[model samples]
Target: MFKLDEAKLQAVLKQLHQAIYNHERWHNDLIRTIICQQPHDHHDMAKDAHRRCRFGQWYYNDVPTEVRDHQAFLAIRTEHKHMHQLATQLLATAATKAAIAPHDYDAFANALDRLRLEIQTLSREIEESLYNHDPLTGALNRIGMLTSLRALHELVKRQVQQCCIAIMDLDHFKVINDSYGHAVGDKVLSASVRYLMDHLRPYDKVFRYGGEEFLISLPSTDLKAGHTMIERIREELGKPPLAFHGSKPIPLTVSFGLAMLDPEVNVEETIRRADKALYAAKSAGRNCSRKWDAVNSTPLA
Candidate 1:
């Protein structure tokens, strides 16, 4: 469900590190040129030096298209271009045996600093995304599940937003595995998670909660709205048949238990409440949804 391009992320990170190293070498070369007052005829002295360098070649020609839209990646491009512009100016002044102004050098230094910072920020973000997502489903895994839900819990506690948690289990998942073998079962799991991710809101989070269960976090949604959203998902899931193993159509269904984030309870307690409701849904029928009734400590009919 996560649209994270793992191959793209890895490739970008590798090239980014190489780019950093190349820039460091360029910096040293520039310093030597300025100090020695040498006639350096390299492209580093050109106005379009940004496009002439190794990093520039990768950025323009080889970097993955997927990562280009990130805020940090965009900032890196701007800062990199600015730094090269200043470097070119400095090189021109140094070649003439003229004194470089302190202000001019400071501007170049500031630009370089910004470029470094943006590169570092982008690397951290990519690493975090890789760590938090499940390798199989590309959904957020249990590794950072509590930390995320807890932050939302705090927001609800402060009355900043309404949030709900839903626990969904694939109906008769074991039967699918037993009937079709484990390979087809994996395909079913992956396909189902992708469907859920596609249908969910942009801000919503889906976590693979082990086996055939997934947990969805619905932000800015109250109990009633959460039910409506999940009901729609359940209905839609039934409408489409997943084609697995050379166009063999297989139908799938899910049982959901939803509960609003309660300010007074711990986040785990809220999850348990949702799980309880999920059990109620499964008991009533395998392909239905239920909401937790906090006042009565039971699933709402």
Candidate 2:
């Protein structure tokens, strides 16, 4: 049941697409009706119609139509279209310049083609994962986590992977903001994340969990190794104070909670266990790491 046949997948995707199309058509038709019945408010009707577009909505019930995922998706397509337009113009210029002067303009044409290829490659990457990074900390955001966890679950089902998730929270982050201002707090979060990335193995992935928390996913790592890794990261992170704007250094520490994947248990359940362990770490003390379901669980220094 985990892997759907191509026909089944096609059917499901087709149904989803059809539903979106139907909703869009309905919205447009309603707008058309309003255009005839209430000509004075056609502008408002048009705006509402776009706002209700299914493809642009995060959730069905969610209003305030500025969906980040939708915007990101559109931005990717728009940029690609713009690049294509540029390439077309470049090719046309190359033709004109060839007639007008020497063939040096051919280099411009070649570069334009290469740029087109790169843009296509970027589009493919974006399709594979929505929004590659968090703008602030340069970590993978929730979108990356969602896409990666799905693929990781597939590998785990094949018994070919042992991935653990570690959730870490900045201890007393609000106090940092209250003591030094939000700008300094922001710098601390970014610096702390940089420390985590620098300390962890290159293959390990870090995603911004929320405002001052992060989720580090360690592939081919079990619970015990994950615990050790998080402790090491915590130790390294505590060694340095975040230097903000080159003025002064602000001390920072993070608490971590970890959970290993159980093939029998769902990923959400595993994450919830890690979340509980995080709560335990926070309750015990600030700067520490803990693993869920550990016997005589003690906080790591």
| Superposed model 1: Cα runs more than 4 Å off | 1-12, 40-42, 45-47, 69-72, 201-203, 238-240
Name the lDDT value of residue 66 in candidate 2.
Answer: 26
* TM-score against truth, every candidate: 0.85, 0.56
Error of 1 at 44 (Å): 3.3
Clashing residue pairs, backbone N/CA/C < 3 A, model 1:
none
Which candidate's TM-score is highest? Answer: 1
CA lDDT of each candidate?
0.85, 0.63
- Full-model lDDT, candidate 2: 0.63
Question: Tens digit of lDDT per residue, candidate 1, span 142-195?
Answer: 978888999999999999999999998999989889988888888788778888
User: TM-score of the candidate numbered 1?
Assistant: 0.85
Cα lDDT tens digits for candidate 2, 22-109? 5446435533543344232232223233334453342234322322234433343343333334433433444344332234335434
User: Against the true structure, what is every candidate's RMSD?
Assistant: 2.9, 15.7
Count of clashing residue pairs in every prediction = 0, 0
